[model samples]
Target: MPRLLWPLLGLLLLAGCASNKERPELTEVDQYREASESLESRNYLTAIDQLKELEARFPYGDFAEQAALDLIYAQYRAVDYPATVVAAQRFMRNYPAHPRMDYALYMRGLANFNMEKGLFDNMVSSDKSSKDMGAAKDAFRDFERLVNRFPDSEYAPDARSRMVHIRNQLARQELHVARYYARRGAIIASINRAQYVVKHYQQTPAVPEALAIMAKGYQRLKQPELAEKSRDVLALNWPDSKFLDNDKQVDLAWWPDEDDGLLSLLTFDLL
Candidate 1:
């Protein structure tokens, strides 16, 4: 009688435990699906709210991770740089080993890239305050990390292309400032800027222009030997460069002397 009573008691406890266990809620799933649909339709604000709510309610759950990633994307698409950075940082912290970690890092970089100053805007220092290019540099560094860590990622190619574009823009801005100084009769300032462009961005299209400016600036300072050397390099690399026409008459002063040889050949023809 005692053994039979103990077995009945155990069965009753098991039944109670089973009855107390709650079933998984479908509300979060429903909300996530609706928010995803809204995001697909370009209703980013609504999607962001829904994703945020889902994450707050389901924190530490699988859907929470998904919500965080979606929130980052929605913020990115809406051009909310600050929010995007926050979301990306949070996603990295929560899902450190996630397969999409590369994407989050890349997007973080892009958020800062969008905030970078324009090339022409940077040149107008008197009108506009000087801009900090640190953000652009950071963006490039992040993209480089993505490339190095995930070389086979689909985003690597575009990241590389954007880096080149940003570098070229920076180089072009420096060249523009150098020309501005040269035009203002600030020979030393112009030479300094031009030399910086040559040293830092030798591969850019602005290199030829920078070289021409450096030559012209040196010539103005009465450094004819250095001016001639720069001209020789410019002629060898970009004979038809448009920058050669920047200072129309001034460039002729540095042009190599071919008149003597031409006259000698013509004299021989006359003979």
Candidate 2:
């Protein structure tokens, strides 16, 4: 063969092998099976690719819907929660009444739940400013939608539990903000944050702290009526609270101004 022709033939052979490697013809079921095996073997990224290929090749195949579903799960297994949420939502839009619709919705909520869960860790830390409640709020809405739409779905119970957790976390976050403001003598801001917890997260466990913060804030603001009202509500709800231990002591009903001396300021919180 001529030297030039030999080189051209080698190029053609490489192209042929590359094409075969790029798109080896596989049946939809075979492709899905490979994806499933990849998922089971913990090769989530590979599973996602294979599942996507299957879906593309067999848009109307018997395994197409399942491939799509599996892709969502694979994305989640890969710790790609954002992509998992997107995939899950797309599945729901494409198959609103699929037998696994509940599963997709649950995953959507799960993703947001994970995002919000980080706020809990940040909240417990000293840097209160690092707290981020946006994800928690989004998760709450997602779980709420799941509960409302699929009350009987197997995932409903878990979703409800997550929602409750998120609610309590949010209430605590509000209380945290209230405390931060209170420490800075921002009494009005402190009271507002505490009231938010009472109004929005009434079912949460943080209500007592909210009420207590409000009472203290009202007292510092020198609004005796509102402070007494807050204390009354707190007593009604939490009669055994430490804040009310000195309630009967009229002298201790309010703290003296900081200028009164270090002793007055020191005992202000206890009073």
Candidate 3:
């Protein structure tokens, strides 16, 4: 009977330990749930504050992990890109093996992407020069990394789509610089930039414009043969491009006199 009493006492002690350990976690989880609800309602500031409290009270617990994720998302939703980046970085550093690691990485990239400025917005209207393209380029690089590393991730398709747009924007910015140089009579500089755009962004919408600019630049430099060649390529690739009208006006008399009639046929002003 004494031995039976000792075993029963041990069972009671174990039960008490289990109860003490579980209650705090349950309470923390309930708090986290409430904070999440606030976030869902778009009360970002309040949600962040609550998430901070939850993290403080349950550091190293299950609720803490969830709190961190919510905190990052709240900062992002609030358009606090800098804070969002920091929080995402911290989360990745602290929870490298977390089940939601892909989400954290994707959020980090998204934070940077959201902070990127369009080239036109950053350009100086007087000179049409950009103050800085670093942020935009960094954003593109970050998104590319995510897509390459997590090809099967839910964010991969969107990342790929955005990358195409980013590439187009970058190409357009370069084209703007080329146009500025062309207008200033800096033929060499303009040709180099336009060529860069044509080579690198041939698939983008800017390609047709870039090719046209290159053709004009070549004509300005007295390279009539090269200019006509570029125009022909542009017409073949983008027959309906607006630049074709301008290409037609560039004189190509330097070509063999007999070929002038053929050049005229190709250069007919469709617009």
Candidate 4:
């Protein structure tokens, strides 16, 4: 409130700001420790910044390698999938035989796995087959490579589980495409897509539906023999199939249909 004190107060505030701003940057070891601490504390942004600083200042050492791995994990925790993938791949490429290769590979798969849109989302969108499955496909291959190359790696089991999930999703995506083509009267394309699911994704939950689609599609194409063969497979594998019970009607009432309350019927069971 006093006029004479105002200049002094302003000077004090400016000095405080300068002190805060000019605080010494951490040394390489200190920066690496800080990044590790931040990662432990779940402060991903701070961890990422500190890791990047450590990497830039000390580019080739054990600490740098650890920092790079930390950076990938931090970016992933921060939901920066693309950055995480790039960092993981860089780590793998730079240190092909590093003891942590399993981690890098697993993180790469996880980054793309997290990037994929939901399965049912692809089902109802314009065209499931035409939709760019780049991320899903990439994730699947990444996991497959991990499982195949490092079967005993600590991360292999989880990678194998993810591969199974990706396989099912891919199969379901194909089935959704088959359904779309069938509805649009593209018999050959529909049959091909369905057969792809049954042949390539035999173990997936979508196989029975794929076979059923093939049966209905072949019948529509006027190939009774092929239809009967597909029908036999569908019946043998899934005697209780709803599609089997519905004959050639395509009993996929879960998807939108104008004849019913389309929005209400959307259950979105991807399988």
Candidate 5:
């Protein structure tokens, strides 16, 4: 508490700070070992910084390629999807023939796949089919490429499964658009959208719904022949489809009615 002693204490604190800040320069191997330790401890942000520094300082060092791969995984584990995708892409571009090429592709696809997810996605059903499909489509293509290019890769099986899920999502998206148009009295547009799902999505679960929409749409347009054809096809292909009421009429009660104005918007139709 003395005035002279206070100055000395301040000088000692500053010297300690300076000593902490002045770390010895680390060798490439040492830097990589530090990053690996961070990664092992699940300190992804710290690992990301360390890995990036390692890559910058020794781009072609023995650990450079592994560092790049770890960067992708670190960014992903940090929930930084966009950065994960970028790092994965850079790894693929830089090391096309690397033994872990499939890993890079898988991470890229996985990043894009989860890019549309919200913070509460695990708690609430956000209806992924209602979200923008750009990232989903990108993820689909990435997974497809992984499957085609590395069928034997350990990641290929999961990639194939995700591809199937993405395909169904795409089909559901077309059905969603069709339902929107139908609710707005856009019969032709709804029919066109539904037909596109049937034609392009084939065996997807949405096919039955699409056929039902098309049937109802044609009936609304006074095209009885087309309506009958759609109904017949639905009966023949999906005998147990809920869209077929006792295999006679189209049952679309599951589809929402026309917009209910402010009430629908406020309640999101849950009411």
Candidate 6:
């Protein structure tokens, strides 16, 4: 061979060797099987990587939908809640009429449900009611949508039960704000918030406190008739309520403390 041709031949042989050593691309089924093995082994992070690669490689393949579902679960198992939520939402949007739509909804709600309890938050023992309820509200809406759309879905019963708990939490959240306002002497704001808990969150434990707030607020505003009405309702429905005094009137303790304390100043005595 000519001198220039010899060098070119050597380069060609090296390229051939490299090509021979290259691994073959995985088939859709192979990728999915690998991902499933990772999941079964509880190697969720590995499964997440494999499932995502499977999705990217076979976006429109036969196993695409299943890969998407598996990715959602893998991310969830890995504690990647935000990613799980996004993957679940994508699945729902892509497969709106899929038979397992309810499952997707349930997972999305569950992801958001646990999103509030990140690692650091879980370490501390804090009151759930006192924490920000944004994620909880989002979770409630998702569960509600699931139950409404798939009343007979296998997940419906659990969704319904979660909704009841969420409702109670939301009621307490509102009452907490109402109490804060009451302590600040923002009587009208307190009354409005309390009424919201009563009207929208009926049957919740917060109702008795809400009634007590309303009755006291009315009395402070010099609306004797409205105060009497609110007091009567509290007496009738929650006779054993802690807010009721021996005389069956709204307990004086239910109202804000008269002393202008540091907490009142810090909270600005306003809602």
Which residue pairs does candidate 5 place in steric collision?
none
Q: Compared with the true structure, what per-residue lDDT tens digits does model 3 show for residues 129-226? A: 24345555766777787777778889878878877877877888888777656555566787899899888887988787777777877876799999
Best of the candidates, lDDT: 5
| Model 2 poorest ten-residue lDDT run | 248-257
lDDT of 1: 0.77
Error of 6 at 231 (Å): 0.9
Every model's TM-score: 0.70, 0.79, 0.71, 0.79, 0.87, 0.87
Better of 1 and 5 by TM-score: 5
- What's the lDDT for all of these models? 0.77, 0.77, 0.75, 0.80, 0.89, 0.88
Pull out the clashing pairs in model 4.
Answer: none
Query: What lDDT does candidate 2 reach at residue 215?
Result: 73
Cα lDDT of candidate 2 equals 0.77
lDDT of 1 by residue, 1-271 (tens): 9989999999999999999999776587788998899899999999999898888788876688788888999999987888998999999997899999889988988887776544565467332113456667778887888899999998889888878876777787786677555555566887898899889987888788778877877887789999888887887788777656554323533222335324434564242
Error of 3 at 165 (Å): 1.5
Candidate 6 clash total?
A: 0
What does the lDDT read for residue 154 in candidate 1? 87
After superposition, which runs of candidate 2 have C-alpha atoms over 4 Å from their true positions? 1-23, 116-130, 246-271
Clashing pairs in 3: none
Give residue 241's error in model 6 in angstroms.
1.0
Q: For residues 1-271, could you state the per-residue lDDT of candidate 6 as single tens digits? A: 5989999999999999998896788999998999999999999999989988988888999999998898899899889999999999999999989999999999999998888785677678655776699988999999999999999999999998998988898899898888878787678999999999989999999899899999988988899999999999999998988999889989957466545433575668542
